[model samples]
Structure formats: structure tokens, C-alpha cells
Target: MKRPIRVLVAKVGLDGHDRGAKVIATSLRDAGMEVIYTGLRQTPEMVVNTALQEDVDAIGISILSGAHMTVFPKVMELMKQKELTDVLVTGGGIIPEADIKKLQEIGVGELFPPGTAMKDIVSYIEEWVAENRNF
Candidate 1:
């Protein structure tokens, strides 16, 4: 049997609010994907390293501290350095639409804003993994 998709959900930087991260983690787990949730106050390097060690198929970052600009790019850079290019780096929070576009331009995947449906998030990750990850 093929292994289930593995995802690492993280909260980078000083974002103390982790309710959303926890929700995403649980939802993903319920969707049959394995989720590794790194609790609050993580750095970009730490997130990437954990993703590597866990061999996750994606990294879902939950940021509400207005650090999307710095956090996403730093994670992307670290992923590049670690040759984790196949991993999807998607997330959600209070990010502006323009910033989302910019982050997408920089190779970050879809950035869902607050109130995005859980099914949508689940479907996106499922489709992304189906297309990108070689099982």
C-alpha cells in the first residue's frame, strides 16, 4: 500500500496564537494525512529542519503576527538550501491579497486567508501532493 501524505504544520516566529494551527493539524489528520505540528514560536530554519527530518510532503505555516513577508521567504530560502523543492509550502492567516500574490510569485504555494473552508485546504493539499509527490 502507498503511504499516506505527510504534512508538517508549523507556527513560525513569535506567533503565539496557535488555535488555527492546531485546527489545521487536526483537520488534516482527519482527512487521512499524517500531520506533525510544531508548536508556537518556531524559526524558519527550525521549521525547515523539522520538515526535512520528518520527510513531510508539505509545510503548512500558520502566521498571524504580520510576518508573512519575512517568514514565507525565509522558509522558501531554507527549503531551497536544503533541496526540499518538492515540498509544498502553503499556509493561511491574516495575509493581504497583494502579499499573497507576491509570495506565490516567490514559489510559495496557495496562501489562504482567514475563513477559508477546511475542505478547500484539504483538497488543495491532496491535489498538490497527487501531482507533485512521487509516491
Candidate 2:
């Protein structure tokens, strides 16, 4: 049997609010995906390292401290350095639309904003894994 989709949901860089990250982790678990939540105040390096160690299919960052610009790019860079090319780096928070576009331009995947439906997030990850990950 194929392994379940594995995702590392993280809160990077002093983001003390963890309710959303926990919610996403639980929701993904309920959707039959394995979720590893790294809790609060993680660095980009730490998150990527954990993703590598966990062999996760994706990294879902929950940022509400207005550090999307720095966090996403740093994670992307680390992923590149670690040759985690097949892993999806996607996330959600209070990010502006323009910043989302910019992040996407840098190879970050679809980023949901606040209030995005849980089903949508689940579906996106499912489809992405189906298409991108070689099971």
C-alpha cells in the first residue's frame, strides 16, 4: 500500500499564535494525511531540517507575525540547498495578495489566506501530491 501524504506544519519566527497551525495540522490529519507540527517560534532552518528529517511531502507554514516575506524565501532557499525539490512549500496567514504573488513567483506553491476553506486546503495538497510526488 502507498504511504499516506506527510506534511510538516510549522510556525516560523516568533509567531506565538498557534491556534491556526494546530487547526491545520488536525484538519490535515483528519483528511488522512500525516501531520508533524513543530510548534511555535521555529526558524526557517529548523523547519526545513525537520521537514527533511521527517521526509515530508510538504511544508505548511502558518505565519501571522508579518514575516511572510522573510520566512517563505528563507525556507525556499533552504529547501533548495537541501535538494528538497519535490517537496511543496505552501502556507497561509495574514499575507497580502501581492506578497503571495511574489512568493509564488519564487516557486512557493499556492498560499491560502485567512478564512480559506479547510476542504480547499486539503484538496490542493492532495492534488499537488498526486501530481508531483512519485509514490
Relative to the unseen true structure, what is the Cα RMSD of model 2? Answer: 0.5
Candidate 2's TM-score: 0.99
**Model 1 residue pairs with clashes:** none
lDDT of 1 by residue, 1-135 (tens): 889999999999988999999999999999999999999999999999999999999999999999999999999999999899999999999999999999999999999888889999999999999999998
**Model 1 residue 53 CA deviation in Å:** 0.3
- Stretches off by above 4 angstroms in model 2 are none
Cα lDDT, model 1, residue 10: 94
Q: How many Å off is the CA of 88 in candidate 1?
A: 0.0
lDDT of 1 at 123: 99
